[model samples]
Target: MGFILLINFTQQGDSDDPQSAAVEQFVIGENKVILTMNIDQQVTIERAGQGWRLLPAQRLSNQLIEQMMRTWQQVQGQVLDIEIDRSQQSGLFISMVLADQPNIQLFTLYLLAEQVVVHNHQLDRYFSLPLPMFNQLIPTGLLINQS
Candidate 1:
């Protein structure tokens, strides 16, 4: 399956809104998958072993994307394509896919201040998160898609 890259943005007052991203559809074909990113700055991505992960809003920094793209470009064996949704200004839903084979799940990493937050997408929806025992809960990985 192919891959798609989506980048969604939030309106001025909608910065705190959670309904800013959605997954429309993903079609896996003979050697590629077609995806749509109708959102402004939001993107949908699937890591090899990871089923699907929703990347919403402009929470992703330009530097991060550039770095990722550079690394992705150097790859030559299997091809991972990307599509972006660009219909809505802030809350657009797009679609994407990853390599068909299974592998270590792709993870999204966020850097906040002096801390780092890394976790799978599935457990991100829990209400009462199991905050680390650390005395300070660092503001790492802004969950822009949440309330």
Candidate 2:
């Protein structure tokens, strides 16, 4: 007998918002994956051929990629009334591009000392997602093979 393993990572949010649309590609901030404190090595993950593959030839587990996509598709949070500090470093940057349109919608998630904030450029709104759930969305410990 074969068993199917299903995983759900959907979060409730405004469906009418363009930022809430499906994410076809994503470019995660460098600090989220790298441990050397350098913010220049940004890693981009997108659809390659038939499956997902990280840029620069990094080996990533299929499960990890699927989880990330699920988070992007089902991420929901409350819009914060507080102002965002632009000086603060961003934890993640998610971008979505439509096939018919030439513009790319950008979303930035800022990790603060006490809370996490996500800024949807398309909607021009600030959202606060649970710290634990945000952490799960960020991919880590990916193998970077340079051989």
Candidate 3:
């Protein structure tokens, strides 16, 4: 992952002298996971503008896909300050392609009997989410691949 973020600074206000300067803050551009592949390589969800598409042509509707993407973006969790032993957990791998990043991001999800923990390797952080939200994040039973 060789993605580099570049920030541009612009001069604000009309100042004849270059002595006093106030820097204007602009959106550094948020990174969105435009494409994601499942752990089993069974399904792929990709974002195209305002819509989303499922690879292998699942029977899922566009509205549902959009909702799933929204959930992925808006979902929040409780921060876990401690480290988890990922070796003993049953987990899944998700590979994502951020909108503005050139490199792909990888994440590991450890599903427990209670909560779902996601390890954001990029940020080196962990989040603990509710157990039921797992279905919304990666809805099961969509693995019936079409020829």
Candidate 4:
């Protein structure tokens, strides 16, 4: 069997222009709602102390999730799937796949606080997850499925 590489829209090299090439296409394991580009560039989105941050592709920390869940008053049922939507100008977009039964809809935005604000879009109100915590929440099952 043959495999393909995926490129995210947000990642830019030395050039000013954004990387437009789709090296390969893949969806996060299991949940079909989250789509990932460029497996090499897969960064987990999570929440940090009083802010958001990004975690490199690797093992997810459950402790972070526990902290975020307590701070943000979020539960597993509230989050469907978290994905890196590199198409936006804010560095990244944490697409919140709502737990809509039967059909999952990508609604709301878990965006970086620097380039965006909570009220800028409707998604802001729901999941204002910090990048670090978001990244820690990366589902291992999903990562394995991508393989």
Give residue 75's lDDT in candidate 2 (0 to 100): 66
Candidate 2 deviant stretches above 4 angstroms: 1-41, 88-91, 98-101, 142-147
lDDT of each: 0.29, 0.55, 0.64, 0.34
Q: Which stretches of candidate 1 lie over 4 Å from their true place?
A: 1-67, 70-96, 101-109, 122-147
Candidate 4 similarity to native, TM-score: 0.26
Candidate 4's residue-wise lDDT over 35-85, tens digit each? 121222354444455443435544545555345334322322122223444
Q: Candidate 3 lDDT, tens digit per residue, 37-132? A: 454476788766667778878777777777666777667666565577766665676777776678777677777878888777777667778898
Query: What order do you get sorting by lDDT, best first?
Result: 3, 2, 4, 1
- Tens digits of per-residue lDDT, candidate 1, 1-147, equal 122222233244366543432211111223432222122233543332322233554555544544433332231211112222223212212222334533222223332343323322322321111233111211124233433
Better of 1 and 2 by TM-score: 2
Residue 83 shift from truth in candidate 4, angstroms: 22
CA shift of 43, model 2, Å: 1.2
Residue 112 of model 2 has an lDDT of 74
Off by over 4 Å in 4: 1-60, 69-88, 107-147
Question: Once all C-alphas are superposed, what RMSD does model 4 give against the true structure?
Answer: 19.1
User: In candidate 2, what residue range of length 10 has the lowest lDDT sum?
Assistant: 30-39
Name the TM-score of candidate 3: 0.67
